[model samples]
Structure formats: C-alpha cells, structure tokens
Target chain A: MKVNAKKVLMLTKISKSYQNNLVINNFSLDFNYGDSVGIIGKNGSGKSTILKISCGLLKPDSGNVLLMGKSFDSTEDGLLIKSRMGVVLHEDMLYPQLTVFENLNFYSKILGIKNVNTKIEELSTLLNLSDYLKISVSKLSNGNKKRVSFAKSLLNDPDILFADEPESNLDDNGKEIVSKIFNDRRKRGLTNFFSTHSEIFLEKCSNQLINLKDFENA
Target chain B: MLNWFKVLSILIKKDIKIEFQTKETLVTLCLFGLLIITVFSLSTENNSLINQNFGAGILWSSVIFAGSIAMVKFFYHEEQNKTLQSLLVMPVPSELILFSKSIVFFIFLSISEIIIFLISSVLFNLNIFSLKLILGCIVFNIGYSVVGSFFGVISSKSSSKEILLTMLLIPIITPILMFIIATTNDVIRSELNSNFQTWLGLGISFDIIFLTLMSYLFGKILED
Candidate 1:
C-alpha cells in the first residue's frame, strides 16, 4: 500500500482486542489537515481504543498508524510525532497532588515550551481556570478538572489533538468553551480526532462523523 | 543530549514535588522498615550472638520488604490517576520515565535507609557505619531502584499489584541483596573479607546490567 505523505493521520487495517474479546477489527481511517473528525458509538464500541492507538498510547495488535506521515515504529519517529500531537483521555491525567498551574507547567517543560508561564496563563484564562490555578486538582470539582485537562492538551498548540470523550462531566458553559476551542482549531487548519456521545457536540465541533457501529464485525 | 537532560530534570523535579506534598512514599518506607527492625530486635533481645551474626540479614530483609511496599504505593498514584499515560503521550523517551522514577525512588530509599540504619545500630548494638558499607548501599540501591521501578510499572497493571510487585522484584534483585548483606557483614566485623572485592564487583555488575537491560525493556513494556 502506498502511503499518503500529505495526510495528517492515517490508520491502516488496525485491529485490537482484550483477551478473546475483539474491540476494533481491521479498522481504517484517514484524517487530513483542518479536519475535525468525531467518532460516535456505544459505550463498548472501541472509541477510546481507536483514539489511544492513534495517539501512540496503545499499540494495535495488527495495523500501522501514521501521524504526520511518520509511523511509531522507530523511537525517533515516535517522539517526533508525539511532539506534534496532544491527547485527552477519560482520566484527567493530572497529578492530584499538584496545583492546576503546576501540572500545566510540568507538561510545558516536558514539551520544551520556552514561555511556559505565558502559555499557562493564557490557557488558564481561556478555560476559566485562572481562579483555580493555585488549587490542587484533587480539590477541584469534576468539571474544573476536565477544563484543566483540556488546557494541558492545548499547551503545545498541537498539530493534531486526540481527545476521548472531551466533554464528559463538563457543564454547559464548559462544553461551550470546549466547542469553541475545537472550532477555532479547525479554523486554524489544525486537526481534531475525538469521540463523543453528544450529538450537539458533534454538530458544533466535527465536520466529519464516524459511527463505529457501521464497522462492527468487519 | 541537552534536551534529554532538561526533560529528565523536569520529570524528577515533578516527582519530588509530589512526594513532598503527600509524604506517602517516604513515610511508608521509613515506618515499615522501622517496624520490621523493631520486631526482629524484640525477638532476638536475649541473643547478642544472633544480633551480631545476622544484623546485616535483618537490616536488608527490612529494606527489601519495605522498599517493595513503598514502590507499590509510589506507582499506584501514577496508574490510578493515569498520570503515567499523560507522560507516555509526550515527546519524552520512555526510558527517561524509567530513569526519573528510579532516581526519585533511589533518593527516597536512601533517606529511609539512613533512618532504618540508625535504629538498627541502637537495637542490634553494632556499628553499622563505614565507607565500605556506604559504597555497598549506593550500588545496591541503584540496582534495586532500577529493577524495582521496572517491575513496579509492570505490576501496577495487575489487580494484586502489591503481591505481584514484591514477588517479581525480590527474585530479580537477589544478587544485589546478597552482595549488600555480604559487604555489611564485613563492615560489621571490621575486617576485610577475602571476597570483599568480589562482592562489590557483583553488586556493581548487577547495577550496570539491569540498568541497561531494563531501560530497553521499559519502553517495550510501556508500548504494550
């Protein structure tokens, strides 16, 4: 199969399973620059698994994942691809012991962002996390924790963002803020690959939709 | 290379900061180790010869068991909150994650060892301090931390993580445990045992071999 070097993300014949239970089988998709793709499916439809594999968080049993035309086969390539991508999963992935600002600051340094404080400040204000910046994540409510996770994912202004259930546990205003961020990313020609159960969120953020049920048993 | 060091330092600093906030790992390590020492001290109170002959064994058994328990607690938060998944998505090399955790564990282990050793000296009535013993501790700590960190992450995925981590860790680190016990014995006796260098060599070799092998394996394990 000839690879498309211009595509932003590509998954060719991906298959994943847990023990004898298969989740995703021979699944394939292509995402390009400026595309906002949202996947909708039932609770066990492997939406999170697809996003995880696409972001290199989980290895597919049989498949090739190409991000920015580079595969995760080589460590060097994997790092290069990861540097340009961001992910938000069901778990907040923030240290409960660290304050909101500290968590963002730590991740910024890992991403080698030069102006870490400025980036954190901007994100905090945008996500209405400015007031909670000094608060430990463990002390925050579920909605606020979700906002912080969003801010962390956007710290790098990644070329592609992979979010699993990006709006879960969020209030209406919080969902609006996230929808706006996704819309803005699409307008700026960045890519977003996300899974959501809300049709409202899907209409507001995604230009392309994938129903995992259609690919069942394929 | 410079970038790698910068990222490593950031990870290490983050871990240290979290540890300070909770004091969970250090407190667990020190308390558990001290408890073991206290138990042995009470049981062997009547036998000075037992204390003299098996002080090294007693100290290390405490360190090993307590270290395993503490390591389980250390990685539990990473797995529970999915913070490790957060780091895995970043550009940081997986080995750096292993190294950072190992370094942080090494620091905590060293601090706990100091407290445990002091209490053991008073309880066993033996001089537990010497340059040779310190050297042996450093080498042994490196090997233990690296191997423990590797198995710690692996076992954190299991339902019975506490049991699995101890089961996996103790067997892999047997050589280092033996080396440290032998060196501590020589230090206590205040005589250079004929095989002192040989023991030191074994400890050093274990550190180097596992550090290299585990660093490589850590990446593969995380990928799965």
Candidate 2:
C-alpha cells in the first residue's frame, strides 16, 4: 500500500513581465505535501519573482495562485493563506535598531504564538544564535543576520516555507543548519520552496528541481 | 477583532521600542521644531501686534513642517531593513499596520508639540493654556498623523523621499491646516468668538473623515 500526497500549492497559467520583457510566461507548477522544490536561473531570471507571486507578495499580471484549494482573490483570502506559509526573501527583513530577541519576540506576538520565549530559545539554539539574541541586528554580521532571519520565519511552524536564495551569505555550518532544517520540515510532511544557484545546496534540500531558464527562455 | 487589537498593540509597541533606542525621529522633530520657533520669535520680536496675532500661526506652521520630517523618519527604518515586508507577510491586516503607524506617530508628534508649546509660550508670551486649545491640538495631530503616515509610506519608497513627502503631504493637508490655525487663533487670543466652535468642529470633522478614509486607503495602497 502507498500513501498519496495532496496538492498543497498550485500556480496555473502564470505570466509576469517587467517593462517590456517577459520574465515568466505561462509558468505552472503543482506542489504536494512534503515536496521540496528549488528554482534555478540566472540573475535576471524570474525565480524570485515567481516565489513572490506564489506567496502573494507580488501579483502576477495574469494567473491564479491556489493554496489548499483556495484562490488568492481578496484581502481575507491572502491573509488566511499567508498565515500558513513562511517566507524569507533576499532581504533579512529584521529591524536593525532592535535586538534579535526583540525582533523575534515581536513577530511571535503578531503570529499569536503562545509561549514565545520558549519558542525563541528553541529556534535560536538550533540556528546557533543563542549568544547573539541580546545584540542588535545592525551590529550582527551578515551570516548572523541571515540566521536571525531564518529563525524568524520558522517561529510559526508554517506548513509551506518559501525562501529566496536561502543559502546566501551563510557559512558552511549555517548552510548545514538550513539544510537540516529543510529536511526536518520535509520529514514532518511540510513543503519547502527555494531558489538558489548552488547545485549542492539544492540537492541537499530540494527533491524537485525547476530550472527557471527553461520556463523563461521557452 | 480581538486578534486585530492584539496585533495592533504589538505593532505599535515594536515601533515605540525601536524609536526609543534610535531616537532619530524624536531628535529631528524636536530640533526642527525648535529652529522654527526660534526663527519666528526673532522675526516677530519687535512687532507687538504681529506677535500676538500671528503667534499661533507661527507655532502651528512650525509643527506642521517639523512633524512631516518626523513622519518620514518614522518609515525610514521599515524601508531600510525591509521590515515593512515582514509586517505585511504576517497574519495581521494591512489596515491595522497603518493604524499602528499612525498611532505611534501621533504619540511622537504630541510629545514634540508639548515641547513646542512650552517654548513658544515662553518666547512669544503666548497664553495658550486653555482646555479647548488642548483638545484642538489632539484633533489636529490625529488628522496630520493619519494623512502624513499614509503619504510617508509612499514617499519613503521613492528615490527622493523627503521632497516627495512634502509635495504630497502639504497640499492634501491644507484644509486641516486652516482648521488648526483658526482654532489656534482663538486660543492665542484667549477669547472664544462666534467662529471658534465652527473651526473646532471643522478640525474634529477633518480628523474623523481623514482617519477613516486614510485607514481604508492605506490597505489598498500597501497591497500594491
């Protein structure tokens, strides 16, 4: 006997462009539970844009994004789907003037997570950021800030995690931690989608590979 | 609804905490306000009637300009680190984000206004110690902060944020400015005239309308 995975996210007939050039044209993909995908492309490719549009950050010129069988049509719809998804874009998205503790604590409160301190401590320890919790984000190194950003995204234990260039500005140990986190989430029947240029990182984290060049150039 | 208030409180608290640490907006607002009050006091020192008649105008004009500076600075951190994107991705509604920013900016503006009020009262011998004046100031701040925060987010995304904020802010807020100036004149004169109630009513109405309108518009503008 074999178990069947349900479709968790679907992007259909998606097309996006900037100025006059087409970035993503008629692009579509269906992701099932426990599926991990890595989008690969050149710098000007629409990999990040695709991730953004799928997560409701950037709207596609013409397409529909369906999450758990619901369409992104209204504010309420977007909010409902977004709450179940976590995103880490290229930017750290942490307040520079605030400490790591403060940043994570604030997000936890907004996420309505109970026992926030315990959650912060657990994630910080896993990311090797236990000692930097009290330091301001501005004073942290790029790798440390990246780790903090990663920790912030996992605070809610999202079912779907979308990361744009997840391995950027990270040391080998940091990358290993991120890869391990991805594997852990996948083992728990969650889904992960990320865009990266590193083949090795993609192999370690993603089970499905999407070369965005094939979509954009075709 | 309960969750909305909780998220609103968290957003406001986060902004206040960051501001307390950096003090960038506070310093700019206070220093700019002080400079305006100083310039006006010196310019009107020799003229008794002008000082008495136009002192309220001078004080409010200073606040309007200085408060805009603070509003722009308030959104600077969010743009710098892309924290606005973080907030938008949360479970919270976009309208609540605008409301929180407006509330935080209002508190900051009110604090600076108190300092401006004290300094102007001493320098220009202004008798601006009336209950109606206090209430009017609250109404004026509400209108300014709501509209200013809305435009501030837009301008902060532009290449020329400071100029863009002023250009978008001043014209839209003209009616509110007139209402405040009229109410301030009555306070400065220490006499409630026939038009005092009318101006105060206008100011309150402006606050209500813009606050509601801006809160709705903020969600739409931010989503785009």
Candidate 3:
C-alpha cells in the first residue's frame, strides 16, 4: 500500500485525566484517509476518552486535535469538520422515546440529507432494522439498539466514523454487517477510528491497531 | 450559507413529535399543576386571610414549581440516551441546540399554564381571560424556558438533579416570579392597573436579557 494519502486526523501530545487519575498521557498519532485505526486497551485505559476528545465531545487537558487540518476552536471550523464525521459513544445516543425510523429520520434531517425516508429505509434494510422501524428504542433489546445506533452513524455516509466498542452487543451476524460496512467505507477512502476489545472484530474491520498502554510510557 | 431556520424547524418538529408520542412532560406538568392547585385550595379553604390578594402568589408558585418539573423532564430524554452528545457533534451550532430545547419547553410550558390557569380559575373563582394575563404568561414562559433549559443542562449532569435544578432555578427565577405574581394579582382582581404594566415590563426585560445571555453562554457551556 502506498502510504501517500492526505492526513485526515492528528492528535499531538494529548493528555487527559479524571479526578487526578491520569488516563491518557501524552498520546499522539496521525491517521490518513482510508486508514482504519483500532484502539485497544484494558478497562479505564482511555480508549473511549481519546475517541471522545478527537471527535470534540470531550476537551483534552492539553493538546491539539486536528481533523482534516482544522481544529475545533472556531464554531464555523468545528461545524464544517463535524459535518463530515460520525460518532457512536458508549451510550446508544438514540432517543428512547422515538421509534427506530424516527431517530434516523431526525439525524438525517439534522445532517441535511435529502430524501429522508429513502435514506432511513436504506439504512434500516442494511442494519436489518426494517421490522423494528416503528418500535420505540426503549422497547428494543440491547443488540437491536446497538444496530440502530450504528445505522444512525452511517446515515450521512460520513467521511469519518469514530465508534467506541462498536461490537459490544452485536451478535455474529451483526458483527459481519458492521465489518462489511466498515470495509466498504474504507474502500471508498473513508477514515475509521474505533475503540474495541474484540481482537476478532478489529481484525475484520481495521487494518491498523494501537494499544493505549503504549501511551502510558510518559 | 444554508439557512438555519429550516434546520431549527426540523429540530423543533422532532422534539414535538417525541413529546406528543410520549406525553411525559405535558402529562407530568399538567398533573402536577392540578395537584398543587388542589393542595392550595384545600389548605386555604374557609380561610379569610387567603383572599384574592394571595391568589396570584398561589397560582405562580404552582406554575414555577410544576414548570421546573417539566423542564427537568424535558432534558431527561436527552441525558438518558446521550442524545445531547449526539447533537453536540452534529454540524449545527451548539446554541441552536439549546435554543431548540428552549422553544420546545416553551411550548410545553404554555400548554401546561393554560391547564393550570383553568384549574385555578375554577377553584379560586378567578378570571383567566385578560389580554394582560395572556401577555404576562407569554413573557414569563420565555424567561422560564430560557433560564430553565440553561440550568437544566447543568443540573442534569449532577447526581442530585432535581435538588440541584430547584436550588439553581428558584433563585434565578425569583425576579420573574415576583413580576408574574404581581401581574397575576391584577388578572385575578380583573383590574388592568399600572402595577400590571410595570411588572409586565420587568418580565419582558428579564426575558429578552436572559434569552440573549443564555443563548450566548450555552455554546461555551457545551464546549466543555
């Protein structure tokens, strides 16, 4: 593989801690377009924290996070960069009171994706959620809810996807579907950065891997 | 630049749709409002000390207390599933998210107030149809929703959410409550006096000032 792609994400000397317990220490990495980086770590090792910081959900104690050469300092720059990204955190992030279809539809409209129904229908079909489109998110099982979350992140055909434990509640078939989606997106030069503990899942979906323990050397 | 009005409209629509589907905020607010009125009516029955003069105080206390509950319930949905975090990462500006929340809660609070007014009117034998009263309600609702939504986000992040919300909310809304009570007193007495005008002016001022300030601070608050 010719590693000449444009750098899509960069984290330089990032440091973060909670309650005086340092989680990520001087972490640094750069990801180019089409690079599928999987972050692996033990519990409380800051895999999710790094993802959150990179996606601008959590501000790092000190460091710079550049997405496509722009930081999240200015609202206009932040909005422009985030418009091309998607994220799935530990929580499902879908409204429990809303039906599966309504949740997707809401996000699609927010992202300004036209033909909302068609976009939602396509994602529902891809995620095997067509039958549950009318069902409230609170009524769905954990695995089903995970599928809905994944479907939401993919609704806009995001240029970058940041997911934490994307395979947490997924079954084998669900895992395959997610892996296929990731692989397809990668082939189209979309960047994927995710945190997970499943080696098998990472192997199927990612081409590069980083262990958070290495960052603790500081 | 794509106009953000359409985005705001869709955001409001989604919130309204979810609210109508669950009826959590509306039902809780209205039910709590009615219960407060019943308790007040019972406590003051046959008590000459509690005449029309105190009726405004009683009515607004119920409105503020019950409105606080509805405000907390309004944000609960966003916190439970981390939907606020989802919205934070979206392309839209952060202040717009807060604005949408305030708008939705404003609508719910208005509906809740109508029910509260009807119940209070029947129980306390007070009038409820004055244009001044309606104007006062609108002003009060805007002030309540903007300040409530701002503090509601902070409180929802705490372990003691309801207590924190009340502690933070009650003090900030004290001025608005005072003005509302004064206006309501005139409404209950069916007298459009200078006092009503002064209070309404104060309430409207508070609304405009707080709405702008909260909207400005909202984005900074979410950046953390």
Candidate 4:
C-alpha cells in the first residue's frame, strides 16, 4: 500500500458492465507523476464510468487497477483510494442545505484538516466563494455549486485530481480561475485526468491530450 | 475533541438552517404536537381519574409519535435532494456521520418532548422539577432517537420509506418506551417503596444497549 510518486496508478485491460451493458471494454490506462490526461468520448462512451471505476465507485467486471502497486478490491476500497484523490464528477456533490462556509467547514473537518480556517479562507478567495460563504447553498447558482465541489476536491490537496466536465457550468472568469488552479496544481506535481466530451480543455490547458480524435489515443 | 465536536456542531448548524428556512419537518411536527396536547388537555380537563392515570402515557406517546414523524422526514429530505450521497462521500468515520445526523434528529425529538412536556405539565399539574424523573425521560429519549436513527437509515433506502420507518421503529423501540413510561409513572405516582433502583437501572441499560448497537451497525448501514 506504499504508493510513492514513482509508481502512481496503473490500469490494465479495465472493463465494466452492468446487467449486460458493457460500459468499457478492454480499457487500459496509466498515470505517471505530472501527467495530465484528457479522456474524450461521445455520450454513452463510458467516459465518466471509467473515472468511477478507477476511483472504485463502479465495479469493473474484469481486469485490475493498481495504485502504487496496491489493488483496489471494491467500490468501498475505491472510496478509500479516492479519499486521497480529488474527484469532481459530472454530478453535483454538495449539500445545498449548508452555507458555503459551513460546507467547507464540514468537509475540511471530515478531511481531518488542521489550519482549515486558513485553508477555507484561501479557497474562498481563490474561487471567489467569499461573498457567498454565509449564504445558504440552496440559493447559490449552479455555477457556484460547481465551484464548491471543485474547492472541496482540493481540500486535502491530493496527489491526483480528477475533473469530470469541470468546464460545463462556468463563465469566462470562472474558467480562468479554474485554469489558474489547474496550473498551480501542475506546478505542485499532482497528476490530473480530465474526462470531457471534447479536447478543447486539453488543448487549452493540459500539456498533452489523449484519445481525442480516435477511440484509442494512448 | 475539537474535530468530532466541530463535525457535530456543523451538522447541527446545517440541520437548524434547513429547518428554519423551510420549516418543513419541524413545523409539521409542531402542529401535530399541539393537537396531541390539545386532545389530551380536553379529555383530562373534566376528569381527575383520566388525568392522573393516563397523563404520563399521553405525554410520552405524543412525543414518541411526533418524534417518529420528524425522524422519518429527516431521511426523506435527504433522499429528495441527494444530500445523503454527498455526506456519505466525506472521508470520515461512518459512525461520526451517523451520530451527527442522529443528534440532529435527537434535537428535534427533544424539542418536541419539551414542548409537550411543558403543555401537559400545566394542564395535568404534573411535576417537571424532579431531577430523577426528568433524567429518566432524557435517558429514554437518548436511546429512542439512537435506535430510531439506525432503523431510519434502513427504511430510508427501502421501498416504503415513510411507512416502513413507523412499522419497524415501533417494534424495535418498544422496550425503550416501556422503560421510559414505567420510570416516569413510578416517579409521578409515588407508588413504589423500594423501586427507584429498578427504574434507574432500566434507564441506564436502555441507553447503553442501544448506543452500542447503533455505533456497531452504522458502518454497514453506510455501505448499503
């Protein structure tokens, strides 16, 4: 279970199916240090499903996923692994009942964060969630909620950050804000895998792109 | 100490915010709590016998019933909004999440109990100042809500969430209710000679048994 940066993550012939629908067939991927990968596919191409399987949210029918040589046995184990990784899936992963400040407070505490008051302040300013901190999340626009999810994913500053359709619900400034965060993360040597419908984000942000023009682009 | 406490407090804040803003769950419980108090007050207003005999039962049953409504509604709100899924994803001990939420339900239940306790005490002229009797009520309540939360999470994921919580919660929590009422009546009626010990023992046992069971099983509940 001692996964150093030298050996990040490995997936060999990863496949997933549910009740006979094969989401991904014979999919293989690898993550090295400082790697920024874009997973591009059309709708129903099992893009998000691949991310879920890697994080242990979805069960792959066959094949293996290795993170620093440790195998993720099940979905629960995936969450354990994912606890060390920041993931922003296409879904909205936030509680609207909580204010922006309270949402960060709760998540940072759960992350066992210390200096979290400072951390929250930093995140708020970086993402511009300051004015909305005390307001109920129920009143926040969709864009703000997505920013909350993004900030939460950075709570632990994991070695890897997964962004699923991170650019879908943002204005020009929000996109710039995210791009800056991505670059800062890159400087810190964090591995990032972005899954999207197009490679626009990759061309604009990632140093390299993958699987954009074809089904297999490793 | 600070971490879990902070989690507990944040969870409480979130629940109170939701309650105050929408007034959906607690408001409904408050209306029902008032009706139960009204009916019991009217029925007992004219007769001393009914008032003395069934007053504690009436008060406790109203609390138990109203508490169930709120307990079940708590889960319903989470289900409708997908909030539970987000909470589950947090990297914390599963029991902490369960207990933090159970504490919220406990607060709602305690509030309902206090509201009814105040109303019924004035109407029936019952004693609310006895330390031992009040402690017994609190003890019973702790177990009641703890067990209620365990089963509430269970029913919330099932087919008939609201209906199943009542059906399942009643049978599971019967022992806690019996002990609470028995202990309450023992204190109020001044009937037992050597009996303070038995009531005290039952209260402690009820708290211990259910709290342990809840913490033990909450992990599996989250996985489900």
What tens digits encode model 3's per-residue C-alpha lDDT throughout A1-218?
12233788999999999979988888899988888999999999999999999999999989899888888998888988778889988799998888898889888888888899988989999999999999999999999999999999988788889999999999999999999998999999898999999999899999999988776676
RMSD of each: 2.0, 2.3, 2.4, 4.3
Better of 1 and 3 by DockQ: 1
lDDT of 3 at B83: 89
TM-score, model 2 to reference: 0.96
Query: In model 2, which regions exceed 4 Å deviation?
Result: A1-5
Q: Who is ahead in lDDT, 1 or 3?
A: 1
lDDT of 3 at B177: 86
lDDT of 4 by residue, B149-206 (tens): 8888788777777788889888877777777777777656766574666766877787
- Against the true structure, candidate 3 reaches a TM-score of 0.95
Provide backbone clash counts, one per model.
Answer: 0, 0, 0, 0
lDDT score of residue B99 within candidate 1: 99
Candidate closest to the true structure, highest lDDT: 1
Residue B32's lDDT within candidate 1 is 96
Clashing pairs in 2: none
- Of models 2 and 4, which has the larger DockQ? 2
Interface RMSD, all models, one decimal each?
1.7, 1.8, 1.4, 4.1
How do the candidates rank by DockQ, highest first?
A: 1, 3, 2, 4
- Model 1, A20-122: lDDT tens per residue? 9999999999978989999999999999999999999999999899888988889988888888888999999999999998999999988888789999999
Query: What would the per-residue lDDT of candidate 3 be over residues B109-211, giving only the tens digit for each residue?
Result: 8998888888787787776678888888888888889899999998888778888899999999888888887777776676744587678778988998998
The candidate maximizing TM-score is: 1
lDDT of 1: 0.93
Better of 1 and 2 by TM-score: 1
Higher-ranked by TM-score: 1 or 3: 1
